[model samples]
Target: MSGTGEPLFVADGERDRIEVLHVEDDPAFATVARRFLERCDPSLEVTSETDPREALDRLEEESFDCVLCDYDMPGMNGIELLESLRESYPELPFILFTGKGSEEVASDAFSAGATDYFGKSSDASEYEVLAERIATVVEKYRTERQLERSEERYRRLVETAPVAIAVHRGDEIAFANRAAADFLGVDAPAELIGDDPLSYLDTDDRAVARERIARLLADEATMESLEERYVDADGNLKHGLVAGSAVEYGGERAVQVIVRDITEHRERQQELERYRQLVEAMGDGVYALDADGCFEMFNERMVELSGYSREELQGRYAGDVMTEAGLETVEAAIQSLLDGETDSVTVEVQAKRADGEVVPRELTLTLQPTEPGESFAGTVGVVHDITDRVKRERELEAQNERLEAFAEIVSHDLRNPLTVVEGHVELARELAEEGASGEELVPQLEAIADATDRMLSMTGDLLTLSRQGDTVGERHPVALAPLARDVWSTLDTGAATLETRDPGQVEADRTRLEQLLANLLENAVEHGSTDGQSSPDDPVETPADGADEGLTVTVVGTADGFAVTDDGPGVPQEDRDDVFERGYSTEQGTGVGLAIVRTVAEAHGWTVTVGESAAGGARFEFHTDG
Candidate 1:
């Protein structure tokens, strides 16, 4: 095929279809150029043009693998044609084929965007050089095009990535995406070009960030992910997590950062940590157990209480950590929670601590499942040391036993003597009256009888006071108005009037409540009535203390509890606190009346405060722990 007598062997890969155009002033030379290329590869499809102008025009309408144009053509020379065609197709393969072979023409053609040049000869062998030039230029063009396409795709991928992405090389910033611009508090990434990324870090954190980057670049450390504070647009610090890896960017190796905003997540983590610290620092033991009764989490207080480290308690069974008695009660409570029988449970256990000190503890367990269904997630336990409570209870039992013994003595031993004394005084009075000789001794006999009766009454009152220490557990709804009226009927109110109001219904001891009311009413009549009538003891002239009667006592209901007040002489503020003492008494009053009222209220879990009444007298209000 060529004068050199060399044969062409195509490679074992798929051959590219080569399309080319040839131009010359003579039609014969155009035909020759086509033959030279076809001889190089049979896959070549070469179109020939005799007119230089027509060849340039045809290029606009069709694509070609390579363009071959002759020098010294009519309208355009080889170099001129190369320059003209390159205006539209700069990368189109163009080879100058010319009979005029000179360094001047070759230099001119190459400078005018010619891909290669050929010295046209009369010998057909010279055509081989032209064929080689066309193939080489086309192959080079194809390689460059593929590289451009690959680079384009990579750019688009980074641009549309979800996280904020940036490319930085040392202190120079190369490129950044839209998210990166927003994250960096800039209008565009172009503004960040050639700037250090550490500018976004706080002053104190910048050095740390720089160290991390240095380590990553040196391959000494992998900064795959790190959380750092970044200053926002307003110069306020925010949290961001930087992730991703080193990559080649902008013709140099750079670190490609994918920044994620973690401000909210970090805040939540901080709050959870604060709550954990608070729980750990508490005096009570706090813990959580999974459905299988294995410890899920336990605060520091729990570790201290159990004498175990945080590591020792991990995944350990709660029952296994507890003493036998404690474990039994705790497990029962947890079982009740799991069975959906109770929302919470409290049990007293004489548990042994790590130091081998056995003491009573109150274990309160609450279920915390995600749903209301029977599926058990876990339980939260709050433990309190009830050792002091148990000690006080034991002491109270002993005191009650002694008081019961004292009450028996007062009821039996003291009452029998007072009964005999009263009988003798009555017999003496009868003798004075019947014999008619000791008329002068009758008053003395009557006075002695009165003293014995008063002694017996005081003995009975003391016995009642000693016995009311037990809680008022036996209670029924008792209408207080009817009870007040009934108690008033028994009271000897000489010139005092009783007023009853609807005190609602209080759950109280029927007998004890009536006794409490009786004491309160009797006290009102004794030392009451600022507008004083005659004292039962004095029989002296005193003004009436009420709008109608000597004194008025009111028993009425309040929101939480009830009150017994009187339009009578109120206790002074200074004496109010001492009035609850057992031996406390006022002028014209028995020493034991109000003290008895306090004892009954305390037994019923009620509190009383002394205040001035609306009528300028005593207002003893009973407030229940509602």
Candidate 2:
């Protein structure tokens, strides 16, 4: 491109067409010159104008690569035209070809900035010579412009780069970017120019720097970065990573180096390594899960708890090792934290092991801490195995249940028998004071004795439950049928009948099992009566008066254990769930009978459930496999 008002100049070799403008005073001569130039070079496209002033007007309106003009004729001479064109189109190629040949005219044409000066003659070869001159001047003009544009682009790239960039010409700094100046604590890159680059590096690293520069300039394919220390403008030491390669700068071999300050980065890495060691040494299982709920980090304790190796668990989804219910619980907790509803969550879940075993575990989860202005990345959790703790809690609960039953008996059951005894004693006193017959007094005494015996029996049972605390002493094989018959004989069942069917042996604590059986039989005998009487303790619907009769209790063997069924009004469907609770009675007796039965069954590691019997009575089923 011409610097004087032209858009851009297409290089001669690269251009598909070259346009030329010819100015002459004679119209015929201008026409002939245009034809001759075009014929000499098919790539040349020429336009002829007779008036020099008109030629300048055409040049202003159109684009051309080169201009040809005559030395003399008409209003302006070639020297005058060349001088006038130079004012506006300084870089445009111009050749002065004239029929008037003189040493003075040629010297004036060149002085006026003509790219070439030639004398026109009668020889036909003159046109060819002029054509070559036009091509040479235009190509040189375009080549110079291309090189200038390229240099400008490279300069901009170096100045704006983030890392420190410097070009070393021999042993002196030929160039330095803004970043290099800032890194060296200088006000501007000009301050670093012409200084030895080695002067910036520490004395200890100067030798290595020199060797590296030599290797780079030799083009030995050195791509490795060097860690070197430098002295800033303030005379303080600093660290950087430097990389360099051989390059050409201003037609001279040079080494272009890029420097990155990494002092802070190295310190941060050291701090992180310390934290990693602390985490690995923790006792409890610690784990970190990424946003996708996959394991990103864990300690040795975590591997042991999960029974999975580090390689197996890394990047694996958490759901793969957790039970479905547990995974859902954890997911919900994570959502609650993300919503800012909670800072942390602790939950007990079943962890499925690689060996197909389920282990009870407690986990405390919290969002991983992040730097300010950073988003939530993942979760951190600490795991604890709570199997032993859970077992102890169950035992404590069982003991509490027993204590509750004992309190009820002492408060209500024992008081009732004591009140009965007091009433009978008062009646006997009145009978004696009125001089009643001895026979009448004897019946009152017997009633007092019966009440006293009942109180004593309840006291003994309470003492046993309180002292034992639901703990079974020892286990032995016992026959169910004989045990039931023996317990029935001891109970004052009134008119109730007992039936045994398919008796079997069960491993149990004999003393505890017998007490369990006795309580069940007593519960049935006391409540299974359809006597049309609703005791204060039993709040069920009373049967019809004529329906008064004793009920039959049956002991039946089951595949896993046994059951006690009674043929009487069955327990209310709504009340079955609470039947074994302390103080929940459906009969005329202490409400603790079934509660003791449950305590004993649990102590023996058995499960008990109450349901309706086929004969419209309550059925108590005991499973030994609990």
Candidate 3:
């Protein structure tokens, strides 16, 4: 805008610092141009190149506000240089300060995108005019470059923002960022240009978005965030939280909208509702307590397990529900979690039930965080009743002690007398053979020897019965058919046959399990059938056609466990309950066989029951643990 020669000297304070690129064919003239340009305004820095083509290459490498060149030069001229630079940098200032004073050349300079034109002069006043023009052009170029840089930074920030951002003029979208385009299911931001934001919303929410936009433009309300549903390109409803505010854009009032996706938050709310329902229906007590051990939250199961109403437990301390001993345990467990010694702790305590009975219960506590450093904020607890488990353990201990006493009695008391009686029978049989009166006493001596042998046999059974198969430590999957055949080998059965049908695997201790199978086999052969035949070389005779037919024993696998069945006389229904009684014997053996089988089964947490087999014989069924 500096036009007249006198007004050109009007200074706009001190001029801004700028670098200029000057090109001339003469090295002496390039030096003169730098001197005068710096003298006009001390803030200007001028770089000169004698070769005009090299100057253009310098412009491409280095940053400069403006380019100064002569109109006439060898090979490429100033107009040709201006035309070449225009291809990439149209905003760069190119001024012609040449010796050629032709109006036609000046017209061509401006047409090639020259910023200003000046003719070379030896006059000192001409250099001053040219310097002022150079300063003005460079200052204008620097200001426009700074504006472009600032807009570039803002554009980058909007494009990469996590939330959707769009600038709207009236109802149409003027600009949109990458996130905004993606939210609308478009490939590029330009596709949203001239599109209405309301069109992306469902029909139900479009009016709400319109009303909010109207209120923002009218200045009737301050900026507010709201949850709404927007429709994507596929017409699927998408949940979002959006905020809109009036902003000055493009020299007009426009709305700048920011939207955040909230579909995950909605899904989380639904999940929490389902968890609440599930916890309320649980059987074990579930509760949450604060760091001070006061109840913060609880489920319906907690009220039932603690024997307290919801009203009573709402603000009550958890220690009040537990006894002094229980409180001691509770305090230690909570301290362990708070000190970071462990993440969770479990302990057993006595809890008072609603019926005034103190039930044995186990409580488990887990650490939780309310804030970053305050991870000891609260503890989640689960209480489970263990009364039955405790009672069964005590009964098992008492049963073991009784078995130990029985073994001692059989070893010391019964064995000594039976051994002495067998010794006397042997001496009497030897005396009867040596003397004449001994012939009559030989049968009596032999009868006495047979009675002692029977007594010894009964004594051996007593000791074996005293060895109650109590504990079975680690159980393995034992194949029933092989184990049954092994057990049958140990038993003295003659005509009795062992049959296995689908004898699948059962988890049991092998040695103790063998004993169980041996007892079951003995019971089947001895007491199962009175008419069952023994081996042809045996002394025991069979009563023909009694309750036994084939006298077959079967080991069959059941769903939960296995069964040992027989085709002999079945136990009467009235006597089934007393079959496992300790001293109840029917025929030749100590009655403790079935009782020992029951003991071993109990140790493994199995249930033993006697029922009639399919062929009218006794079936011993064992059910495995739950």
Cα RMSD, each candidate: 34.0, 25.2, 30.8
Q: Backbone clashes per model, in order?
A: 1, 1, 0
- Per-residue lDDT of 464-567 in model 1, one digit per residue for the tens? 76665534659888998888999989977778888877677788898888888888888777657444422223333223331326578898889998898888
Best by TM-score: 2
Name the best candidate (by lDDT).
2
Model 3 alpha-carbon drift over 4 Å, by segment? 1-397, 400-469, 529-550
Q: Which pairs clash inside model 2?
A: 1-9
Give the per-residue Cα lDDT of candidate 3 at 463: 62
Better of 1 and 3 by lDDT: 3
lDDT of each: 0.73, 0.81, 0.76
User: What TM-score does prediction 1 earn?
Assistant: 0.36
**Model 2 root mean square deviation, Cα atoms:** 25.2
- C-alpha lDDT of candidate 2 relative to the true structure: 0.81
Q: List the residue pairs that clash in candidate 3.
A: none
Evaluate model 3: give its TM-score: 0.36
